[model samples]
Target: MAAGDPNHVLHVARGIEPTEALAVLGAKPGLIRTCELPDSKPDEWTSLPCAALGIQPGTAAALLAGRIGEWTFVYDDLGFTCDDSATMALSADGRTAATSVFTINADASLLYAVGGEQVEWVNVDDLNLEEDLPGMPAELRAAFEAAGNVPTEDLEPGEADGDIGMRAACALAGLALTLEDVRRIPLLVVPFG
Candidate 1:
């Protein structure tokens, strides 16, 4: 989508302030005027960040993204959100978590599970992606960059509560990591039959 592409234009709805709502879709300054509005929230906005979108108790997506280029894929009532790669820690309650969303299948459930990676000790120097799009922290991004296996236990205690938080998961079989080093991996707790 070019700066002025038609499909790339902001899709605003009533009370959504057509010209002003473009920021919610990350459109350029002048591009606001070129928006082709929709009757409701755009189909592209899968899951927006509640904290980043300024979601109030009684507010809806329309009011939320009216002016905010809302962060999507954040942990919410929605289950199991993550970046492109399924790397990261889980919530204390054992839910699949992420700083953003990917191709999420809404019906799937996590029974009792945790995340792990084939690699540990990710090189802290090589991770570079679209930061402007919002994502997980660099520390968690680095821990999974090494050569190894997954760790099902003892993920170093870290923070997986809010966006940009981390929790470590130490290696179990051959995974070499400290408590503060496991956030670089993706995890969940799915109950097995």
Candidate 2:
């Protein structure tokens, strides 16, 4: 803790915004900090350092290399691709009613398989349950509860892919796989906000 650091206790205990916490400590709003980016971009802003925004080297490369809109991102190495910013996410249960089975690759990369099917993510890391999942879609959670663990063979060949079945088996054994298990897991891990 420093004399000018935002009072973490006050911020957490009072449930006040970091800026307000800084105000209590008599720090400038501009100088007070948060790990999350500003929800809405400011109309007028000064260019900050690339390191300041804290983006991943790969993602920054995608932006700088002009591949932000292409299928050429590192995600290819992990085996699946997305044409759009994802509209839904899987719960830690690693299941989704979407068209693909999302899993994590050996290097902790993300992977996916597409086909209209009941999908569940997998982990090459271990057959363990995850302690945290960034988020889960409402539908995915609903479908998981409805389906339960009905055995992979019961899912059928056209029902889902093999990778999903393996992942589900691991989940059944209490493992938690992460999106990063697939290549290019969608997170800006470099730095910022």
**What's the lDDT for all of these models?**
0.23, 0.25
Model 1 regions lying over 4 Å from their true place? 1-90, 101-125, 128-193
Query: What lDDT would candidate 1 get against the real structure?
Result: 0.23
lDDT of 1 by residue, 78-167 (tens): 222222233222222232222222112311111111242222221212222233113434433342233222333533332121111111
Error of 1 at 47 (Å): 12
Candidates' TM-scores?
0.16, 0.18
lDDT of each residue in 1-193, candidate 2, tens digit only: 0011111010010122223322332333454232322233222221111223443322321110001111111111111222121202211122221222232331221223222232334332332222312233333333333333333564532233324433332333222433233213222212111
Enumerate clash totals for all models, in the order shown.
29, 21
State the TM-score for model 2. Answer: 0.18
